[model samples]
Every structure is written in structure tokens, then in C-alpha cells.
Target: MTDTDWGELAQHWLDRLADCSVPGAGVTRLPFTPEHRRALGVLTELMEEAGLVVRLDAAGTLIGRLGGPESAPALLMGSHQDSVREGGAYDGIMGVVLPVLALMKLRHDEVTLPFAVEVLAFADEEGVRFPSALMGPRALAGTFDMATLDLHDSDGITLRRAMEEFGLNPDSLPDLKRNPTQVLGWVEIHLEQGPVLESAGLNIGIVTGICGIERHMVTLTGKAAHAGTVPMHLRNDALAGAAELTLATETLAHETDGLLATVGALHVRPGVVNAVPGEVSLTLEIRALNDALRECAGAAITHTARDIATRRGLSLDIARTYAQGATTCSSKSIEHLCKAVATGSRSEVRRLVSGATHDTSAMAELCSVGMVFTACRDGISHHPSELVSEKAMTAGIQTLEQYLIQLQ
Candidate 1:
């Protein structure tokens, strides 16, 4: 038995964390800012109350460590502390609080974990202020690119300078790389950020893997002509080509087994009522749990777009902008989580793949990674309306604590 006032504690802690944000409608805690510092203060209190030793890593990742038996590797938990501007209260921070509360519940029940546990509040995950993200997890995984330190924020502050001002030694970030041998695994509990779980009438779901993502910047060029003077046959409109390509991408996704493609942004040149569009640019993104599937679709869409351009007498340029391979949750981790789910819920664990990225993807480079997706209201996220019920929070805490107890 435990004294768990789930809604009260979580809601109160979330309120306190929300208050640490800048003056805004939703929480606006960016890394290395006053809001981040204030929220860390609150987390420190929670960590201390849970009987853990707290410290901040060189990259500003706030870590709370709970020791295990001698020579045991640590099981890393928690999520990012920062948020997008006017973002939801529970996006990243809830993952941090729920784990600490799980530890607190274990302590209250006199339950001790067999392996070392660490609650990590990563400094930046949203990349809202900077052009790069996943600094903490990537550093720990030894996959961090040192050149990113030179990247500048909106205010012209270099990441290196911001780290220095935040009392962190940027030079030591590489030194903070976690040894694979010293880490048991990593688990992140976060809002579903999608409607899958909510639509299923479930509060929690186990992640099968994180989708691989790729983006291409596409440009189409054609001659601009007077709309009234040039007939449709004579006009080589770039916007028309772009429209065809967008539909092609959509059709490709719809026909494919697992691919999800989008023309998320588009721009037209020579804005005028009379002039024909001269040029067009857009972003084409494809995501899938299978890298082969994603890459295949990307190739197909690119080829189709090029053909469309040639037929219309338009020139096209497509450049790959970003690519991250898909990451699958370890079978061992899935087995353990299944057992944990049996401990708390009657229904079988619902397994799903995440279309969006998370810190778990980066941590996979260091050790095995798993995720628990807590359903949010109407699957809304990255906005102020994000909501996770206290009942769901309590269920998550129970399962996480059981996970610690059930780990082999």
C-alpha cells in the first residue's frame, strides 16, 4: 500500500513548473534560460525528497541518481525539461515528474530497486531556441557533433557561450559520454502526441520503435509570363508543377504500406494577380518505422516530381536536408515492460510506433531504449491544451515502479 494522491501531487507539481515559465499563456521554458533554471529548482526539490543525489551535467542535463547494488549499471529514466514557446505544461516535464513520483512511491512502500536508477531532465529537446537539439542524450551516446557548439540562438548567443554563462564547461561535453557497459537501459514516459491510444480508449501504450525521418527541399523554376497574355498551353508554371508533386507525394504515402509523406511548407515567387508564377519551393518529408520503406518512398516521390518537371518544361532541384534512421525497442526491454504492464493493467499492453521523435531515439546509441506513451486529451500536443488525466498519471507511476521492481 502507498499514499499516492496522484492528481493532487502531479497537478500541483505541474502548476509549479508552469509558473517557472516566462510570461505567456503556456509554459515557455527554453534551455539555459531563467525559466529552465527555475524549473530545475523545483525538480531538485522533488529529487531530494525522493532520496536521490542530484547533479547537473556539463550539457545542463539535470540528473538525479539513486544507487543500486555494487557494480550495477544505471537504468536511465525521465525526459527533457525545456519546451517550445507557449507549449503544453505536460509535454516534456511530465515525464520527469512521474518517474520521480514512482521513486517516491517505491520509497513509501519500502520497495528497493535492484539496479541503479537515474532521472534525467535533459536541457534541450525541442530545438526551439537553437538550430540543433538532443545535446544531452547525444553527448552521453558519444554521437554529439562538436561543431554544433558554434551554432547561435535567436539572440546571437553561441551555444558555447550560453553553456559557459550557464556554468557549464562546453569543452567537457564529449568527456561526459556514457559508457555502454555502465548503462542498463533508458526509458522515457511521455504523452502520446497522437490519437492512437486515445482512439483506442487506452491511457498507456508501449512503443514498438521510433520512425526514421527524412526531409527534402524541392525547388521548381519556370518562366514568368503575363497571365492574361499567355495561354495555358504556353505557360510553364512552377506552382502548377509544385501542385502536381504535392499530390504525387500524398498519393505515394497513401499507396505505401508504412510511409507518411507531407509537403509541409510551400512558397511561390513573383506574387502578382497578372503574372504567372516563376518559381516555387517546398519541403517534402517522409517518415516510417522501416528505413527501407521510408527511403523507397522518398526515391519514388523524387523520381515522380522530376518527371513532372520535365514534362512541363520546368527545372527542378531537390536536396536532402535531414535523415535519421529508425530505432527499434529492444526485445528484452519489451518483455520486461510487458510483465510490468501485467502488474498494473488488466488489458494487454497496446504496442505502437512513434511517428514523432523523442530522446529515446538518441539514447539508443548508448543503451537499450523503451518508451511508454501516455494518452493526452484528443491527442493534442506542443500546445497549451495538452492534458493527461491524473488517473492516467497514477497508472503510469504504478507501472514504472513495477518496471523497476520487475527488471531482471
Candidate 2:
């Protein structure tokens, strides 16, 4: 059904996203911004053109409805369109556009469903305005209440105010959360955001789970002294302790096999050319597919940091900032997706786990959730140099269309 004209649809949406920008191609479409509204308008028009009755939920989530028999729960598909500042073309836009294109192709072929289908173009999944991510799905799951909305961004802009600017109400959002029994399943088509698919020569991957995340902040304290006066053995340096801890984190991850850890941020108090630093702070991020391994890896990292500090005459402090449990995709939903891909392309399919977090984790709280990933060249994403093969995009659309048909 999507053979000839689907590429045209993809190009149309890609152009739409590209056009809603300044002279430079930066997508500053943060929630409540003028750019965000224009992008949503384009999405609404496209949904209507594809013959779906569309509406915006109380949380400003764009919904497109294709009606069917009244008995079965609806099968939901699609993703977000908002991008991080200057993010790649595919990250959020393709996820929503490809599914819509698939549905449009099905409609063109006169294909109907035994159950209703709704395509969602969620807003603010990146949490650009706030530190908390997955705003749209959290509200839909009834997990984000007024209390969460009360939190403010760096500019002191509350989510409630942001929602109001976009014509939504924070208090009335509970009504928009889907009843668990009313949703058959949820699916998001996204870029792999990594190199696995491209390296393995695969067209797509059926996601089995989204990894858990552990964010920590570590501080090392020592006496500040003149660099030239303090002898090497007598001097206690916080930066030295921090450097040893950073190296230990890498070793810990390798020891745990599946564990992934990084010290992405660091700050040395009184950053100067000729001074012994008195304090050092760094952020530690750890991820794993399994909870037990995640915890064990974290312990190893902390222990190593402490040992290094003790030997160097510095004191260590570690604080837990945030932690999210791992989320697994439903086996039944994954099998269904696998079959859909096989039917569409007749190619061998790969089942993989996502190393990155997504809005799918929030949806999984209310319904079975699965994802499809088109490869990004060199396994890179969230950057301007990001790339995805046109062929993989086409195959991804075909797989989604077939998946929707089988959902009946």
C-alpha cells in the first residue's frame, strides 16, 4: 500500500519541520514557543489531509483518530515532533511522521481496522522547558499531576503556564489520561540513536526494553594551597582524586559487562592556572538493562571513588540525584511487530534492547509498549551530523503499516 507515494509524504513532513526555523536551521520549538505552535499546526493539517479526524487533548497532545468497530480497544501509534535545540531531523519528527504516512497509505488502499487507531504527535518529550522529561505521556498516564506541573524551568516558567499558553489546562489533564483497559498497545518508531543496526547491516530493530538510568554527583574535598609552595607528596588535591575516580568508573563498567557509565560533567572550584584546587564535583551517569547489574555497577563506582580519595588525603561525598527503573517491552507486542516487519520486507528481523530512555517508558505504565528503530549512520544521534538511510525509513514505514493492520 505504501509502495509509490510514501516517500513524498515523508519529504513533505521533513520540509515542514525544516521550514519552521530562522535563517539558521535551529529548532527552538520549546513548549509554549511560537515555533512550537507553528510546527503543531503543520502536523494537524497533515493529519486532516490523511483523512483522520484530529483533536488536541487537554495537555496539548495532537491526536488523530481513525474509527473502527466499537468493541475493541484502540491501537495507538506515533511519537513526538518537538526537537532539542538544533537536534537532528529524525529524532522526534520521523517517529511521528512515518506512522502517519503508514496510516495514510492504508487509507489510500481502503484498508480498515477491526479496532480504532489514534496517531499521537506528543509535545515536550524532551523536557526542554523543564528538567523532567516525557511530559506528554506522563500526563496521559495520569502520572503527571498538578504537583509536577508546578515545577519551573531555568527561567522560572512553570509547566502550568506553558500549558496555558498552548491552550491547555493542567488541572483538567487527568481526564485525558487513557484508561488502561481502553488501550490495546503503544508503539514508537524512532532512530536507533546508536550504531548497532548500521554496524549489523540491519534495516530495523524491534525494541525489547528501555534501559534504566542512575544519575549521581560526586564531590571531593581537600585543602587549597599554593601550587609552587606545596610539595607533591604533602599536597592534597581534589582534582587528582576526581581524575582517579573518573578512570575507575570506566573500569567498573567494563567489569560489569552490560553496564554503561560516564562522568560527563565536572567542576573544579577556583579553576586557575596555578593553584591547588580545594574542591571538585562531577556527575556520574550509569545505565543497564537489568536492575541488579545497575546497582552493582553503581556500588563499584562509588567504592572506587572513596578508595582513591582516601589514598590521596581527600574526603569523598556522593549524592544520588535521580534514578529510573528499567522498562521492558511486552513480549506479545514485540512478536507482533516482528511479524509485521517480516511480512512487509521479508527480511530477517533483529530483536534488541534500547540503551537510551524514551517516552515509551511512561506509556508502558498504562499499556504494553514497543518501538522500532531505523539505523543512524555511525551509531550517532542528537547531533547535526546525524544521518539515517532513506531505504531504512521506507522499510520502517512499511513495517508500521503492516503492524497496524495486524493489530486488528
Candidates' lDDT values, in order? 0.91, 0.83
Estimate, for each residue in 35-116, the C-alpha lDDT of model 2 and write its tens digit: 7788788888888888889998887788998887876788888787677777777787788788888888888878987888
Identify the leading candidate in terms of TM-score: 1
Candidate 2 residue 170 Cα shift, in angstroms, is 1.4
What TM-score do all the candidates reach, one by one? 0.98, 0.96
TM-score of 2: 0.96
Candidate 2's C-alpha runs over 4 A off are 1-4
Q: For residues 174-220, what per-residue lDDT tens digits would candidate 1 score against the true structure? A: 89998899899999999999998889988788888999999999999
Best by lDDT: 1
What is every candidate's alpha-carbon RMSD to the true fold? Answer: 1.2, 1.6
